[model samples]
Target: METHTELVEGEIDLKYSLAERVKTLTPSSTLAITAKAKELKASGIDVIGLGAGEPDYNTPENILKAAAESMEAGFTKYTPAGGLPELKNAIIAKLERDQKLTYKPSEIMVGVGAKHVLYTLFQVILNPSDEVIIPIPYWVSYPEQVKLAGGTPVFIEGTKEQEYKVTAEQIRSAITEKTRALIINSPSNPTGMIYSEEELKQIADVCKEADIWVISDEIYEKLVYNNAKHVSIAQLSDDAKERTLIINGVSKSHSMTGWRIGYIAGDETIVKAMTDLASHSTSNPVTTSQYAAIEAYNGPQDAVEEMRRAFESRLKEIYPKVAAIPGFNVLRPQGAFYLLPEVREAAEKTGYTSVDDFAQALLEEANVAVIPGSGFGSPDTIRLSYATSLDLIEKAVKRIDEFVKTKWQD
Candidate 1:
């Protein structure tokens, strides 16, 4: 027997390497901070994690019961790659009921999660160097997914002066011949700012004129607060509907993050392509999850409203406290469950050079974890999710308040 080995026993071979596509992907700062907080908690520390985007609530009992029934009824086998027709009908009913819009079952594509659905969409739509316009302070995954599909992410700054929302003019200005799509996230992650109806119409007009696709991420649609409403760009016009693809799921609204069910509603061709890609990539979403989602959409929605009210209450109670933190200039968010404060002044006043450093110090010293805005393309700010209990949210804000006070240099 010949022992043929060109490498040392403990040495990694140079021939095996990760693909270049994955090389540019950045780790999610929110998950990284959440994991560190968990580590601290595991080691007997009381770490308050405001970094996670998921609701602290459990999946509603009705949904859970439905999932159990599905398994009991022998629904553990593989389902169609697109989803059960029943689930698709429920989603169709939801759109018609909520937005006065109609979609055929052929236009709905279900996947593992909203995140996965978006990844699939990008894969099917983007070609090499096609540009997608992403507004600033975006969900961390948007740009990365575009890049993964060989698309370039072109950003338009949604400065705090504009309530962290890009206008139609901004979108129009950023469009180039390479522009293939634009992503709009109302009740947006990190900021929680909902765009007005007029804003949507103007943006729809721009997309219509430019003849580009609009990817409206309405995952947070059900969580609007203080009388604010969510208007889908697709609802603006038939032309707008034709150009828009809506991505949503039960994760936030139903607290079903772990259930891993999300879907897309759009042109039949696009849905078909995504479905074919999913058949090769995921085969199908979890069988029980699809059943749970059918119940999520078709079942009574009292739990959804109750959770929304709870989040609203928490937001109202915590917003003032978070805003009162010295050097933290925060706008009162109209929707969703996060408070994004421009903290560059806070960082500078506390002798830190960057918000990222300030956030790190907060996790270590104050035992409070927050996602730095650098990950969201807003380097001067930080994102604090209020999806946790009111007590924990209050305590976390208090700790942050004291940390800034203690560290203040001027």
Candidate 2:
């Protein structure tokens, strides 16, 4: 929201209009809140930030070494637009090892990150007026990416009663002739609810019957806890395999967020078109990061499990405390490093007209930052990422609890 200065007496002034696609685009709320917390911290404020979406751990040592070796070995040059063959093969091996899904190199396209890979997928497959089904309380980017592709995002509410998951019947009812695809994010961000294999089976059947694509975003596949299993919709059957596209990356798995490596696996024609688009857009993903991703998949997986264990431990320790806050109701997360609690009652009791305003008050007065659920299509709730230290999380929760206590009127 920056403003431009007026032209001087003799200077020419140019006015340009932004594209329709970007004119109404909403910036990512999670990132915006995190940035604000960092800004406060930079100004010497004692901010306890609960808005981070990335792991606090450094990238695994082996992956870092691999990236360094790739640079030293002159593998820093541009790779193929799709990605390096070796990296794609490693990704294929990962699918086979984890999900028992077979894929060839031609079917895989690596992009800057899972976010960018999704954008590329939508761009290639969507046409004007097409519709994509997005479940409620989705990751903040899904609807925006759909709209950017000239596609309409048709939302289906996933009620808290259903553990914040959309049922197959809902998907069926939401479909129409304009429906081109459906996005499924298991171990969902904000909610941390993992769809069961049976749920995925039912959903896969609906997608096959409807003859629409399923964009299965399994970026948090490796981060499940509580003995819960992660299942890919593609594994449901041959038809599901043909219709589902799996998107994932090393960022969440290997603490490689800064590495900027992610990929999509599906039909070769779709992947090829995305690759062609990327060639004209990004040229290629960072060459060293691609090489590092190869090692991330091929190297020891101990660090990945270690980080998952840490997040699980924090969730167990913090869920009760967060739920204990007056007027806040939170479901225990099955996976990922987030706790989303419905705070509408809390906001009302504390005199805030909206959850977003309550969240801003928490940042300005309570010195903690949390992403309001309005950004994730669940305005009654707020998302608190537990990716920070347990101590910081505890302190932030305490601040929020005390803030509500002080503001309570009834």
Which segments of candidate 2 are over 4 A away from where they belong? Answer: 1-15, 30-35
Per-model C-alpha lDDT, please? 0.94, 0.93
Model 1: CA > 4 A from native: 1-14
Model 2 agreement with the true structure over 214-310: per-residue lDDT tens digits: 9999999999999999898999999999999999999999998988999999999999999999999999999999989999999999999999999
Model 2, position 39: C-alpha lDDT score: 90
TM-score of each: 0.96, 0.96
Residues 30-110 of candidate 1: C-alpha lDDT, one tens digit per residue: 666677778889999989988768989999989999999999999999889999999999999999999999999999999
Model 1: residue 9 alpha-carbon error in angstroms? 18
Q: What is the C-alpha RMSD of each candidate to the true structure, in Å?
A: 2.4, 2.9
Q: Identify the leading candidate in terms of TM-score.
A: 1
Please report the TM-score between candidate 1 and the true structure: 0.96
